[model samples]
Target: MARVVWHVPVTTSGTGSTTALRLFRLRDGRRCAVGFSSPEALVALLGPDQAHTELGEPALRALTAPLGIDALVVDPRLVAPSVTVPAATQPAAPLAPAPICPAPAVRLQRR
Candidate 1:
């Protein structure tokens, strides 16, 4: 089975949301982000209902350096990859053999 890992956490510390989309790490080892069209957007996305802790790139972009956020940027391949499934657990299978023909007896006609 393929192993899955989260990108850790990034803390915004409540800054830098004035511009640029917040970048952060996701649980699936992928970068996450939340782009706000306006100041209202940011406020709506991250409400002041309570001190919020979000994961992924959105949190990373909102985040400044380090804190409670455990966001960790990881390799792309770790998250997604182009792969081919094996036919069976073991390889080395025998192939079918070619066919053989019988000899025909030719009666010589003496002229």
Candidate 2:
């Protein structure tokens, strides 16, 4: 299971909403984030009274640094990478065959 190392609790104000960053250490030794995501959007999709904790900035930077990622900025006006349907321009890459075990399997009977 993925674990949250650092997070900020999200709370709503009178007319405004507040959200923070989140850093997650994935089960496969990878890191993921939700800082650029909006809590309001999450609530909209998941319905009202949703439960989640936002994350912090410093912790995010620290975690991303080791992975050669300097920062994670959110650009609202950013455009999608592909606008039209995708097509394969080149031949598909080849994959290596699965490795075989060096030792034979061993079985023991229970008493």
Candidate 1 runs further than 4 Å off: 1-22, 48-111
Per residue, candidate 1 scores C-alpha lDDT tens digits across 1-111 of 643322332234467353332355576655544333333434454553423333444445346344444444333223435698867877778987867877888899999
lDDT tens digits by residue: candidate 2, 11-49: 455666654334443445465443435666555543467
The C-alpha TM-scores of every prediction are 0.22, 0.30
- Candidate 2: TM-score? 0.30
Error of 1 at 16 (Å): 10
How many collisions between residues are there in candidate 1? 20
**lDDT, candidate 1, residue 42?**
41
